[model samples]
Target: MTKGNLAIVLHAHLPYVRSEEPGSLEEDWFFQALVECYLPLLETLEEASTAKDQTPKITIGLSPTLLSLLEDQVLKNRFEEWVSIRLELLNKLETNCTAAALDLKGHLKRQLKSWKSCKGDLIGRFKKLQTLEIIDILTCAATHGYLPLLRENPEAVRAQLKTAVREHQRLFTNAPLGIWLPECAYYEGLDDLMSESGLRYAVLDGHGLLNADPRPRYGLYAPICTRRGVAFFGRDSESTLPVWSARDGYPGNPNYREFHRDLGWDLSIENLKKIGIKEKRPLGIKLFKISSQNTSLEDKQEYDPQAAKESVEKDAESYLKDRKKQLIKLEKSMKIEPLLIAPFDAELFGHWWFEGPKFLSHLFIKAKREGVKLITLKDALQLTPQIQLCNPSPSSWGQGGFHNYWLDKSNAWIVHEWSKAGREMVSICSGGLIEESNIKIIKQAGRELLLSQSSDWSFILKAETTTELARERINLHLKRFWILINAIKDNKNITEKIIDEIEKEDCIFPLISPIDWKKKI
Candidate 1:
């Protein structure tokens, strides 16, 4: 077994947001991340693939919903169109700009060139990484369900896992060895569902394992196996804060690119809002400069790429030093060299923090030299199976260190409504149905119920982080539940119509096997 383990797990997910009509900005959230986080990360991994020293063995969880969207013909075609538009803009910037502003034009030209270089075959890069064994990608619940709260029916929770397993199979040609519970929200005895789904291990919030009934011996530094034979790795909070914290983290560094102020909003929204009659809205890679707040657009100075690279190197050092200290402390005290698990939302890399991909690339390069072994949760568990049997308490990596963030008074209404609907659906499905096809309808309703119960959607809305879209998403799924439930209750036999409408509007996780969900538990 390796002495000490350092694993980084990134959870990539977003609620199903798509439109049938073409040329929609609503889909840009996915497009932007593909351009910023996903494609860049894949590119970095591919670049490091040949380097013997750059053993960047990463593990990331793509929610089933996200996997489905990635494979969508509609989204793929739309993405191609968006990329083509950007390429044309790049051409205009290069050819039309006057020689007087050569420096500004040159800067814009380079940024656009980078975007153009990474256009087609982006998805192939990820597939290539998996083929190269540089990354071990995992799958989460179909819509990232907060399963602990869904304990009213264990069968419903099982269905969520089953859907994820099937979706993973459909995408990658293999079932995921590890499962990422939505929000790391877990309750005791949830191991049964995980084991049934054939997951070897999963991640938990620090205190979930720390505050277990019989406290974990190695605390958050080691893995815990349940009686069900599933393994659990508690997140290393000590290691996570260095990257996650705003006040003290790398993101707060002054030299890094500013995220808060965007020309998208600051520039005249009037011109950008007009469609057919106006000139195209420049894609923010522009003639304008990047400046901090309180500075007018006219007073802005040029962006410095050199300065940004220097900042990345410094943050990489700070990150390495902290990890070394933590490793040393664990090695001395735990006797068995501890594993440091750092997990974050994948969007953190290039979406919110523009320079974050560079930070990660530098950090990986440094960690390889500094002796940080990046392993997957499955690799850690296989090498060192837990001797101690520990059951984690119910928890989430949210405010108050529990479920309050997703289940507060503001969001409790959602849970109450969904749980009641789930119970009714479960009872209806379990009470013998006449036709086999009717049984399929009941199970389909159950799947929709499970999707609607995703706690992340509600929390995102209530937090006002991305309030408008989050609100719309929660309502959209909730209505699906309402429609499905009413149709089943009324015995209205329009299953094909209902399914067709859902398939057309939001075609995520198309591997929705009603049979897998309806299997007698």
Candidate 2:
């Protein structure tokens, strides 16, 4: 069996967005990502799955939070409607086009057809890709937990892993073999919990390998295993930068779509005042494109979809060339074909880089034809089983590459409350923790507490890109934790008030048990 030896890891995640309103404005953020990123990615994988020359084997991690969103019936229905709205816009543009805008009309038609075929229904498409063996989808923390911070107690970390793995099994109908540590935040002993939870491998920041105590012999090009026998793939900065670094990456391409110049906020008020008879809201239906750098709306040109597709192909080729060089350098030093691990936030594909999905498809085709290997992360880890027994120090892929991103001056307040709450829960539970033989209520609250303490939400809040939303999520979980913890402390019976509130919040991963978690301690 020949292994092509290169692996790609795409981590897809979003904070829980179960809004009360039917058409929450914030929901657009996810709907757009689905249309632009997730569905297109599924399409690319589906096509590649049956390609004669090469069948691609990619590794994808969908956080449990993302899975909940995908499975959401309400969100699913709204997404169908959202896609329909775009289709209608395309129709309006087509009929309204003049002879002078024939090219623009044609471009809109092609985009409309693609959107029609997808219909924003990615769950089915992804399942098809999985069945075709084009990709291996893994699961992460229930809420993309920042686990290292929860390490003070073994049970807290274990509960997060147990709940996440079980949720993955339920969704995929297969136990997840790999895990994606949130933001690749990992510490030395994290593998113990992962291994216990039946996870085979997990990823870490590039520095995790470089900073390994005994030092990783294969460097960033290959995976290292812990004493517990769990594999760890270190992030490769060389390949990651060209796509992640805004100052230098492909998203900044002059020819590609501009994210900041969205018609939603850029269009004239008069043009968007009323979209339809039933719709009291303006949908930003107008279409426009970037004519030149620093060009105002008056100077903007019509959007060209075909030209953008061509640019996707060109950029894809450039990326492969860079990867070839990277692989060559690694093989020279290690004398072994080391795998180049390029893990990215999947949302970056279509949401941030509108042409990213096309670029990825083109990349797989170009690499396979050129004899560049694209393998799954699981297969790569299994290649070299002999690993040094060592633990990685606490670290994250955040700005400071440490907990400071969530605990520092900018976000100190979040931690003060979080730590206080977490410690209080532990102290309360430890005394009579699981004393009752059938204490189902205490167990339920324990799961809620663990989910709420997840560090991802806090870090995202500190970043302030979507601070309020992040705050609400944290508060939601914290509120549930407080209610459940209060019931346990007061020896009061758990009421529907507890379950209803949690269910209403519509949080995923509601299956974890606190008693099972306590055993890990």
Candidate 3:
């Protein structure tokens, strides 16, 4: 038994990115995450658990949209093709390569090998991990909808909860025990809906607990239960900062992979164009190290895989020692074994910070040796079942630590359209138009509505990188939804062409039912 416990959570998400268009940028995001992050994390777990009789515990929140992509037969095959392209590019680079490019070539080969090894059965591997008690899976709100902004319509929020539970059950064959409230966005009574959906616990930012009614005695070190019986685990930033911060985190060390210095931007356009890669953008083959924080892209040093491994080992040991000392300090005066919850975006590891998955694998093994247990949120609660009852404040882990990143002037106009479509969805579904007679159209409308409400579109609008595409996505989904809704209302003949296109384009939640959108009032 360890004196302290750490729960490291990875929230893996991307909005519905499948498209009818070939080489779609949105779909590229999905493929990149799978290649760079998801596969590596899975491989780490697979290798770490090779020893019989010991299961490594990791909590991951897989969003419905992300799971939808992973299960898409078309996208699954395309991801293999995506890997092949990078391997071909590296093969071409091998002839005139520097030592740095040679090392990156080796990395690409291993990624390709792993992709083949999985044989399009990644989800089965995840299920195996859970069955082995090595990974505890959590679901996110359907469509990755930011719940606080959708508070005006409780029915809409309830629909998100219902769909998550339903979709998770379809894939995992069991209801999930926790949810990553999209962006950790929480409101006054969201937990009641979660409890009703049969979830046992959820996580929030530290401030969400600090401001709870009567305050918490353990601050972010303990779970607090709402009157609704749902437990809220606050994120301990102290556990996160050493690895996640961009400016000072261990990932920024001089030997780690340089994220921005890709050969896609450095090579000639004709070379990339031969491989179907577009001009002036990354093709997921980076070859440089972040030699210094202020170094220019062209001057960056070569990435040394051996040196980076050393850095990961040293950093992981330092982190485990720090936590052990922290627990010793807290135990001196505190009554219970302190729990530290460190939650981070899963993409940060192999995608953004190339050494992230390796760091985590090391952290887990080291913690076990140092007498600090790596427990899932579920296991931690079982160890310490006592909870403090309080009403958590309305909070979000967004910009400004509230809802400004979602609700500010840059994207405020979206709420009106989302609310209007949401109210109409509940009304139309409740009005018996959801019958088996017109169920296909109703389900498509529900799908379009969910896609339009994705928080990524609004976040993109604010980020200004793809504002045009973001606006078009939101408006197009809303437009398809209204066309379906009004056509059903008018009893008009809908063209087969339109229906076919929508069925292909908005293909997510394969088992979603019209009843999932029912008004809960």
Candidate 4:
């Protein structure tokens, strides 16, 4: 008999980084994630689905902004060109890293083949896997607006939810039943908004559930239902620590590829500019291994594919063994079957941890042989419909497990901007302007307001990486927002040319409804 269930959730997200210039830093961010993470992940899932017995069951949350990028034909063409350029560069890369270069080339060629096989329609391939019951897809907020911070204007929060739900349905052919709330953040009464958007469940950090109004009897082993009818699954640290902890995790293994040492940083500026890189930045051509935890970047050893493959197998087995032992112990203490939830950022696989996809492949194969029940969050809910009702505590997965990370000294200023813009959006949307030009302005203004509210800029400000870019993005969106709001209010004749330019730049959430911002009585 199965001891318990394991739910592996991967939340995929990226800020709206679409740019007009190819090889721009922002564009590179998206392209690197696609080449390293998304494509490899798709291939892994497709391969796992063909297993004769016990196909892998996983939960994947695709943020609406990410979905929009995936569907953009222009970006797709750019991505193809981006890969071709890298392949050409690899051919001329003459160094002692020949083995590492060859391995990377092989992986990239396979990924390119997979991309071509699907004709670059990754969304469709993921949808097909969902249809096959190999994976369950969850939708996130339209721009991943931090809901707790947006709570002052409930309509602002509503627009985020409604817009996300509409976009998910538009692309996936069905409404998303669950959401990976931005930053795994929650606040009082947020459940009501989720229910209004037709979301049935969400996942939160462990404390959000463990410290609920009435603490859950099963702790983090089972999901709890909120009074508003939405269910919540808490992250299980026991299952996640082994994978996420840098000091203790499998990704830190010496045989794994080093993340920081890349060819882009080592290559001369002249060589980089040949591939359109104007500055010294990561070109994603990593060939070094950790070698030793204390080793310097220059002293790091070359990555060995064979040793890394061996490590993946060893770690996968150990992880499964640990889960089995934990479940067996929990089975004796609980009357209900225990469910272990492991949620991570999807980029961690292949992108952050080069062998992460291979690790997952080994994990699924081991899980089947070891008789461990691997499942999706949806499957876990069906397995236990009669869940405890509890009011989850206000929480986030950020530092301090509260709102401080997004509200700290570096980023506190943006909160007021979000609130002020949100209030204006509600007023203009509720004003019932019937003029065609005004309605058009209102819709575009709504998009800007939503974009400005993305948690990414604030996050970048707090993290202190790319702060200038983050500040520029926030100011850009808010500036555009106020400009359009003024056009609607002042009855100014804004040129169609100006509106088209803004639309072309930040075009996303085509089905966004300004009426979602209307105050509810």
Candidate 5:
């Protein structure tokens, strides 16, 4: 008998990293995520759908920026070439790691076949799954902007939500009822804005609900509803930690493939350049197993695909067993049915944890046998007649359970830049007559401004990984924003070529409106 519900929310997002250069780091980021994470995830879900006893259901949040990237024809074509090149490189592997290389090559070949079967239409495939009720899709903030930080200019926050809704509708043909707030970050009044945008629900860190105005009667097991009518689900730490923590989770198992040790870093730079790579960086060709947590990369043993497969199956069984026990205990003590919300970054599944996708597939198969009900967030809402009403606390999923991670010394500088650009955007959209000729310029400026507000930049700065690229992206957007805003302010006769050039590079949110930044009365 089913004891309780388990809602697994995977928030999928990537910064707008489109690049014209084939071997650019930005391009590599998108391609690697496509090959290692997204494609594998889709394949896993597709495979799980074939099971007759249980239907796999989960919540996946696709940010507007990532949706745009997925729909881009240029990126789609490049992904095929990217896979071909990797396959070629894998075949040329003449080393002690040949077995591992061959294993990865086979996986890639299957993924490539899957890509072909879908005609490289990942977005359509995901949409079809949603149509089949296998998954509930959520929209994220436009460009994955940190909503709480943008709250200084309320209109800025509104623009982010509105643009996301519009873009999601354009692609998915309906407004999203829920959102995976960027970083699972929430502030005191964010629900009002979400309600205004017609969003009905969102997921927040456990504390956001735990520390509510009046403590929830059922705590994190049940969702809380704000006066504004938006429902907020809190993350269940018990359900998340075992999968999210590398040190303590199933992902750290010694049999799993080691993510950090890759063939890209091992190959000579001269040889890499021969394949069009200009520098030494991860090329997503990992072949080492985490023999031990303490083992150095060089000392790691060669990955055995068979051993990793066994580990995934074993770990999935253990995870479901734990959930079953927890749910049964909670059902006995709780007044209402218990819900364990396990929210994670979607990329973690297949990218960071090599066997992540297979693990999920295993979860679906074992969940039925284990008597643990796996349902989507949308389905969880219906479990209770009415949600507990409370004002959630200001919180984020970042370290310290607050905004400090994104607002710390490393990234605090960018906040002012975001605020300044936001205010200017509002001024331009509010004050202007919006000539037919300049509407294009104003819309482009709005795109640039929104791009600058991406939380990824602040995240990168704080993490100190790819800081230079983060800084460059933030400045690039701000610089272009100022140029476009100035042209509108000065009423300069800007050439069509100039505007065309800017649009060609950072083109996203084709349906974005400049008026979204207009100050609310």
Candidate 6:
């Protein structure tokens, strides 16, 4: 048997961003993710799974909103066009570069070729992996609603949980046994709802387990069961730091591609427009490396793809060696088998850090050779026969390790709107509005309310990266919700034009009932 078990969990999520107009900036979030993150990650895993590769175990959380976006035909088609245009953009730069950009240009050509090979079917590839048991797929809250903040509105919490499970079933045709709570945030009493949703396990930060009621005897090395019987796995920070940390992580290496310095930002709007990309946005063509820290964007050196590729192999081997050493030390110190749970945002791989997907592929190969067993959280529990029951403290992986990221002065007003919307929505559906003539508008109203409750808007508000758009999203949904509620209550006509528009834009949860909001407990 291996000395210890290592569970690598990747949480893939993005708030629903659909657009009817051409060239909306927010729409690029989905397309960029598809071309960069989702497609490459899927291809890497497919290649890894082709033979009897028992070492490539993983658990991935697919939030309902992201799953819906991946399954949408419109987005799929747009992704094909987006990558095609960018490939043309790269073709122009291949010969015109200042010798500094040759490697960057060649790198993009290879990436686009891989994208073409994928043919834009990321979700189906993910499903195929699940069927083969190569990876375990986990569910997340509907719209990724921040659950701790919504605890007061239990019905809203239940709705998020219920809707997520339902959607997961609809997609994979099997209920998920694990979940990645939005933000890895956990508060007391959430497990009860998970039990109801049929989720057997979830992952949280280390402090969540360290501060548990019984003070877990094995600490982060083992799983803990809540009073509600749901299993909670705590993330291992030591295992996570090498990849996620900016100061010390692989992403900050001078050889890796820099995330922020995109050529799109340097190009003229007129030049960009001529290329069919009208918006002055990230064209997913970054041409430089981190180079040297304290170096400005203009001062950075050109990226050499060959060097970065070599670094990926070395880094993956170093990471595997370190984890094996740590696991051995931990197992000896504890006098028992230790489990290392490393969970990270899936976007970090190919989207933020260009070599990320390749790093993962190499890690699996290196771990297998070094005898470091790769396992999922479910597999960990099966090995450890005894689990201690405990109550975790209220915590998150956010900036202060609390709810402050979603509740600070910048976004505090969102909590009030969310609570009010929940109360009002419950009143409408439970008050007999579900009768024959008006259920359509009421259901649409619930969709708006649910979308507004998304944790992404509040996060964007606090980050201030796109505040106006975030504010507009809140306003748009709240206004539409009230319009439907008032019309139905006053026995007035619900406008078809309004219904038609929102259904086109914010259409998620094709089967959500407004009554999911009525639970008082």
- Sorting all predicted structures by lDDT, with the top scorer first, yields 4, 5, 3, 6, 1, 2
Model 2 stretches with alpha carbons more than 4 Å out = 1-4, 89-125, 267-301, 424-444, 454-456, 493-498, 519-521
Model 5, residue 107: C-alpha shift (Å): 0.8
Per-residue alpha-carbon lDDT of model 3 for 1-521, expressed as tens digits?
A: 55778898999998887875556677778877887899889988988888553336879999999899888888877776777777777777644367666766676678778877878777888999999888889999999999998878787887788888899999999999899998888888898888888988988988999998879998889899988899999988888998889788898899999999887788898886777766567777887899999999999987888889999999989888888888788777668889989999999989999999889888766766777778898788899858888878778888777888988687999999999988888888777775566788888888898888899999998888889888999999999999999888888879878887898888877676677667755
Query: How many backbone clashes are present in model 5?
Result: 0
Model 2 residue 343 lDDT?
A: 89
Total clashing residue pairs per candidate?
A: 0, 1, 0, 0, 0, 0
- The models' CA-based lDDT, in order, is 0.70, 0.69, 0.85, 0.91, 0.91, 0.84
- Model 3 deviation from native, Cα RMSD in Å: 1.7
The residue-level lDDT of candidate 6 at 144 comes to 91
What TM-score does model 4 achieve against the real structure? 0.99
TM-score winner between 1 and 5, please give it: 5
Better of 5 and 6 by lDDT: 5
- lDDT, candidate 4, 128-183, per-residue tens: 99999999999999999999999999999999999999999999999999999999
Evaluate residue 66 in candidate 4 and report its C-alpha lDDT on the 0 to 100 scale: 95
TM-score of each: 0.87, 0.86, 0.96, 0.99, 0.98, 0.95
Model 6 misses residue 193 by how many Å? 1.2
Model 6 Cα lDDT, one tens digit per residue, 1-521? 45898899999999988876555686689888876788778878888887565368899999999998887777766665666676677768744464436654555566566656656556677889988777899999988999999887788888898888888988889988889999989988888888988988999998989988989988899899987889999989999999998668888889988888887897899988887667677877887889977899988777777889999999999888899998988887776688999999999999998899999999777777887999877778788787887898788989888899999999999889888888877777666666677878888888888788889999999998989999998889899898888888888886788788878888788878666776543
lDDT of 1 by residue, 1-521 (tens): 23587889988887666667554545666776776677666667777777776667778888877766666777776765565554444455443454323433454344345545755444455666777777778888777888877777777787789888988887678888898888888887788888988887888889888898689888888888788987777888777887786556776565555554443444465644542113232242433324445556556554555666788788877877778777877788885668899998888887666667777787667776776777777677767743578777888887887777777666677777766776676666566552565654555565567667776677876686766666666677767766766776777757587677874676555566554434375
Model 1 ranges off by over 4 Å: 1-3, 23-25, 84-124, 275-302, 434-447, 465-468, 493-499, 515-521
The TM-score, computed over Cα atoms with residue i paired to residue i, of candidate 6 is 0.95
